[model samples]
Target: MERPPARTPEGSRKTPVTSGLAARAHRTFTPPELIRNFCIIAHIDHGKSTLADRMLQLTGVVEERAMRAQYLDRMDIERERGITIKSQAVRLPWAAPGRDGKTIDHVLNLIDTPGHVDFTYEVSRSLAACEGAVLLVDAAQGIEAQTLANLYLALENDLHVIPVLNKIDLPAAQPERYAEEIAHIIGGSPDDVLRVSGKTGAGVKELLDKVVAEIPPPVGDADAPARAMIFDSVYDIYRGVITYIRVIDGKITPRERIQMMSTRAIHELLEVGVISPEPIPTVGLGVGEVGYLITGVKDVRQSKVGDTITSAAKGATVPLGGYRDPRPMVYSGLYPLDGSDYPLLRDALDKLRLNDAALTYEPETSAALGFGYRCGYLGLLHMEITRDRLEREFGLDLISTTPNVVYRVTMEDTTTHVVTNPSDWPSGKIRDIVEPIVRCTIISPSEYIGTIMELCQSRRGSLGGMDYLSETRVELRYTMPLGEIIFDFFDALKSRTRGYASLDYEEIGMQEADLVKVDILLQGEAVDAFSAIVHKDSAYGYGVSMTAKLRELIPRQQFEVPIQAAVGSRVIARETIRAMRKDVLAKCYGGDITRKRKLLEKQKEGKKRMKMVGRVEVPQEAFIAALSTDSAPAAGKDAKK
Candidate 1:
């Protein structure tokens, strides 16, 4: 019923082929009509990766002995976290059952995408290379925030969506209910939703057959001028920048001169290949095919994702649509624990950026934390992944400041500035301030609707609309300032709803706000990195809490240290860290009262001298603890004893 696996090389075992051996196996290329470019879209932990693994196994592209869960997840962090951090593409040969009950060979180009809200950009690029998408929904959990989000993206891309209800083998799975929900959301018959179990491989063959029958083949002309879409790329130390491309028209061959439409850069193609889950070198990739190209590109900026690749001699008149640079939603400062490691961190970031084009960073200096980079990311998870990679891969110990969102400030001179870091915030400019706003959507069980609304109200969210998805499930929409949620809103929401609530948000625009900059001063010296912009109404309370937290975190110095929270020249809150008292007269046990007085006075003079000359040493952890706004006991409750 299926084609046999490719013959292993002499003396090679039936295991996963290493990159070298895979390149050596010269394979025949399928015609464009027989090729289907598709991707899997789903919510996090919704069995997208498992379904991909099963597809590869059934197609005989990967041997069962070498089959591990999420075989396409190449990153170690991805495997450890059990999440798909990066989108991966592979080619599989399937023997689809035709109308006459005869088996026909079909080439399937499958791109497995990450299901987190943070990696939505990655999903978009992956979808650009596909003509169809498999929308996987969990039968037990039903729909989620990301499921709808990705479904809309697939529809926007005009891809044929095949709804597959997964995890039906589970005892708790309610396949019928989810099928009805899918039908309601996507406008399909309940019976049309294919039921499958990724764990047991049930209904998988039928799903594949449906893919061949339903999804349309890519349309392109081989005789036309060469035009390809660069969906993704990675930097290799030996081969330089390797770009993954989908050939929409014509063909790309080794030694062919290619030009990037956006950057207007030209290079000779060093190699053309396809990913058999690993790089497999090929002579050329033709129209309606997906593969990779090596062009000796050293700089990642030149090989921008979503850029067009065309023949240098006769380039396309216009680039493809849906090409926009990624804008960061959250900003933070990344400082090396040791300032000398700055260069090492910079180099590591450069290499990492080659793979992650969404990450943005620039050098920034802090008065208290020394030198670091102000980094911007798509979401909180993106920031976490970048930090983890820097520490684990580059072996650098780092400190991160509190995350913040960009704000718009209108000055008295009629000029506006966008501020990402607190130190760069123009507090002296007298005028109005506008903060970014997001349209927040939350879906949860009706029982937790009250709790969700309360949490939203506390975050200054205004209810926009509410709808009942089903009798038990409800979706709520709200408009809220982006600043309120960048810190711990998601964590709080999950805690309040017991992890049943899921959230999705999109930036609406900027709105006028009553805002003020709050500064933290230690011993009358303002710490630049400790400053933050907050609403005027909450400034006083926030200042008091911050001052109290600082008093607890800062260790006692030889001299009394004054911790103050200020708005411009006016101090709003203050706390004092008392000096540690010591017995200088301990040695004089039997001395007279006069002798003791003179010793105490001398000790006092020495203390005064030390206080004037010494600097208070602030621990690195103090900065992190003070800036972290995670829920803690009331400030006075943790007062220093």
Candidate 2:
């Protein structure tokens, strides 16, 4: 008894609800054996969202006419950029027809995760809420760097992985080749790999059947004490904090008192609900079920991700394992454009942090940039997205300094200090400097291997290994300092490879290096915010390029302005901005020789007075140019600061 696809009502824009009130009103508890908790993992732009959309339609969670591409991507930035930044969860009532023409009702809890390396931590949290994962690979593009990274993460978490090749409708799709690649990576039979086309709705029903048959049901005891895992949280003005969770044991209902094992804060559950693409209030969610809890916890910090929720009366002594705090890799200074907006900026950051737990910041002051916050992020993309959200969502104009990686400095007294801000480099007391390093993996076409190798070596990266995925595609691995890739490595890679290469990296450890703090000085005054840490061997070249860029951006003043880059007390590069000239004798046209001499004398005196009192005003763009390595003029051209 195969059910036909549901259609939306005529002239109706609302998504047709199949199991909202009816499912919640007469909700009989689903047995653990009938529930499947799983998630979809893939590389960026690999059709994970499309497959999820198809699944939602097949289960009649949403009508066909109401469907939109990438339906799980809710944020405006996500939709505009075509990337999934946050993980979304939904519950669907799927029924598979048996041989006897009877239908079996099965509950499917699907979580869609982000594919970017910056959001890998979010993916990990989403995976913890599931018992299995659907590994989606693009048939045309094949295996990518992030695909391997995420596959390893799922394996590490002991989740069952089901390999599925998507986009089989494309003319260039080599399903057999990609299937074999998946088999080589995950150690399974190539024939076992399921193929589906998300765009054409071909082979989707078979894929759904495979999911139910191959994926195991979640295991947990409902009669035991209540315990749940909080994987994500969001802030609401009226509801306060809404926490997305997965029930592991027992059950949770409205008005139940629950305690967060990590924070020990207790709150009464105001409401419990499940997401059917939209929130549907439910009576209770039992073990092996995924849902949300409204506890009136005003601050999202209280309902932390990876925290365990248990009954207040009978709490679990040991919480679930694999809970680790997110560590920020990149650091930058964020300052309000107007000095008076400091308090407003602080409030905005507090509100933003309530929802973004990975963002770390503290009060910091720079002599040049003034009062600001020193913020930390997971990676470069994380930093960009956070900054963009602050400006777009909070309506704040901010100035961001150059991003830097954390460094460990050992003092002469054998004391080790972590340096996040380049201005905080204690050069006098430091005995040795250790910089963070990452193991980078790049997947690209074989034709661009030479170009990529050149780019890697230019960044001071050493080749670790290489592999031939196929005759046309290759995988290259390198161990490089994190700072080298923080600036423009991805952009350069895309430029050189014609956007065919994908990158993924993980921090390996720290190693001692000959590093120095390079300072940019304007008119003999050091700008603390413009200082950066670079390798000693490349400091001179970087200084030259930075000074050259600043020279073009800074405006001329009444007195000559000298832009200099120095390490310690040794100046390595310099550029000068000539003072603006004024013809003081223009008004004395066709006058007597004595009158001309008097005018010249007056002009000379005025010039001396102006020079004595005038201070060169460096524009904001000059500071920005000084901090950006990409702002330098093109090659084979004169670049001076």
Candidate 3:
């Protein structure tokens, strides 16, 4: 039998979804008491998505034919990378055996979140919408860095965390050992930590029941005026803007006039629905319910993440605790290959900002790279993914400059100038220059402690301490400059630790350092794109590496070209590109020695005369090549530090 659409009260009508995205609409207004809101948090490849799939199958929301791995990951980039980049929400119907031998049908709002450190902001957003979290750990890998990081966040938010050990069926699975490890951090008995195999679906049902039994229901007043927190939003080509919200008080129904508490802009709700692996229009979304609302808005700016939504008539005077804006840790220059596509890039960024709230950008023009925008991101992975998405989704070819962190340069005049790009460094810097710092945590094998300590020390890291998670696994903590790890630190750590290390970091604050800007000059002319800021000790190495790279890239001219790396007026490193010479003695092989000498002398004089009148012309390709690599360090990698 087919289930009909939800029926509203006699006087009120439920507006239908008109964007052709409407599915079988059977969900009605679920009460706050019966609805359970929670999210899955774990390390990368620790089985969060797989466990979500098992739950979807057991709940019967996703049929057998529709089943697939990482089903909640809806983007091509996500599927190709085999990681969850966005937080996906789906409603599941379940009937738990009640304590009194009765069946209790309840609603489960499951949010599958990304596990990578770069998308921590995404995880935090998911946490705000839920009342509890499922802290998953791999039985074989024990506890990783991200697991602990997320666990702390859940505890901070006061979300009830259910510790789970996944992949218990593996050959090397040590459930007893790791469960005790998790228990140490979460403060519970080892047996209390549930054991389950996401692949075999052994204990997922019991886990679900525990979630319904332990996680407290969200508190709100249904009789109060309508107010919802916009947790996430996306722009659709066919439907304009679709905002995902969690209602904190009252109810939201279709065709109701709503006003944004932040912007005070009024909009009519076109359709209100819940996602049950598909869009299922609901009669109304009451308190404690998580759903999406569409206003038929074509402009993307109106729907902002972390904005509050309330009814236009008799709305709540107070807004819910929304969210604090995420601070960007890295900055890069994103420029279109074609100058005409500047507007298109802007539009793409605006739409992307709706999806990724951590992205921040401002218009910037470079003499070497032309017009572009300086974009900010949470980390290197976030920057890479955003650039990749722009080129693939928008069909725009772009050139990205080297990534760097923001610096606060205090001058002698008691004024401060913040610099994101190297060219912004002032000439007369007399005060302390401060840079951002992060508290880095690394979980690795106990055997690699010596090598890891050496690596961290080489990067100017100060050891915080170390703790043994198990007999073989150790957790190392350090306070390091954010710029040091922005480039190839993760790759280096993986290589040195034999691929047995996991890293996570959070920005703490800024500290003053002895920093100076190094500029790349060709024949006395400074190239703005090749400028970078480095420590006084590493300044010489940076200069030599970059000057050498420029020497190989720039073609040999008629006259000798001098490449120099300078700190203000003092030049630290220099390289000379020898002029291309014409073989004046090739045809005179058998000629007299005096004749050869005379020809060489004549050639030298001619070259000197030409050198006096000729100037070096640096091609655009050379600038592109030099700027593309963040630093051509000793390892010879491009576009990364």
RMSD of every prediction: 5.8, 5.8, 5.4
Candidate 1 structure quality by residue, lDDT tens digits, 1-641:
99554321111223454333233433555578888999999988899999998887787777666778888887777888788888988887777887789987777889999988778889988988899999999999898878998999999999999999999999999999889988999997999999998998999999988889999999988888889998877776556788889999888888989999988999999888787765667878887888888888787678877888999998887777745678898888999989999999888888788678788999998888888999998877777778888988779988878777898888999888888987878756668888889998888999998999999998889999998888899989999998887666787777788878888777889888888889988878888877888888878988898889889999998778889999999999999999888887888889589998998898789879987888877898897677543332111011100
| Top lDDT model | 3
TM-score of 1: 0.92
Clashing pairs in 3: 629-639
Per-prediction TM-score to the true structure, in the order listed: 0.92, 0.91, 0.91
Candidate 2 on 303-357: residue-level lDDT in tens? 7777889989887778877457788888988988788989988977876775666
lDDT score at residue 281, model 1, on the 0-100 scale: 70
Tens-digit per-residue lDDT, 369-389, candidate 3? 789999999887788788888
Off by over 4 Å in 3: 1-27, 583-624, 629-641
Reference-based lDDT, residue 226, model 3: 97
